[model samples]
Target: MTNENNPIDFGAFTEPKKRPEPVSAPEESKKEKGRGERQEWVSRQPAAEPVAPQKATEGQISIKGPDHIIERFKQLCKDDRRVYYDMLEILMDKFEGK
Candidate 1:
């Protein structure tokens, strides 16, 4: 109801300005929170599928017949028998050193 020209001063009733409180060190707040965050992230991950006891392909070789067997045997012999001998020699040398 006061006149616009009078413009009442309510500053006297207002609260005084407050200085801000200092922030605590980041580590004090973050350590506990970080563990919880990690636990949550781990829980959200998908669970791995359980392997079947009797696997469909267990003991089943795709290639069959005597020709395939002969070919496989020849391949195994040709692959790296020399490498196996070299590895054995290295192991023996190490054992002798020990």
Candidate 2:
């Protein structure tokens, strides 16, 4: 369970370095926030308001195909940096000679 006689020699290790003391906020910043308390960075930045999700206008369609073919189609779309449905629409339009 235990390896008292290891083949490799790890060698002597040096002592861990001590962490630096935490820096207090500037006098002006402490005065703005309140004395002795650290000013959090998040408080300095504007608060993010919740955004409403936009609804998609286009209707959705389901697809059925061989796993390998589907994977290759998805990979092709990814390589072209195009959305799967957008790529299909473009291909269909091209085939229509439009």
Error of 2 at 85 (Å): 1.7
- Candidate 2, 1-98: lDDT as tens digits: 23578755555556789999999856776666745566555666547876879988888887899999989989989999999898998989999999
Model 1 lDDT per residue over 24-85, tens place: 76664656767543224447655887676885552423545799866665565567554434
Using TM-score as the measure, the top candidate is 2
Structure candidate 2, residue pairs in collision:
none
Model 1 segments more than 4 A misplaced: 1-4, 10-16, 35-98
For model 1, give the RMSD to the true fold. 20.6
Report the Cα lDDT for residue 10, model 2: 50
RMSD vs true structure, all candidates = 20.6, 11.5
> lDDT of model 2 at residue 1?
27
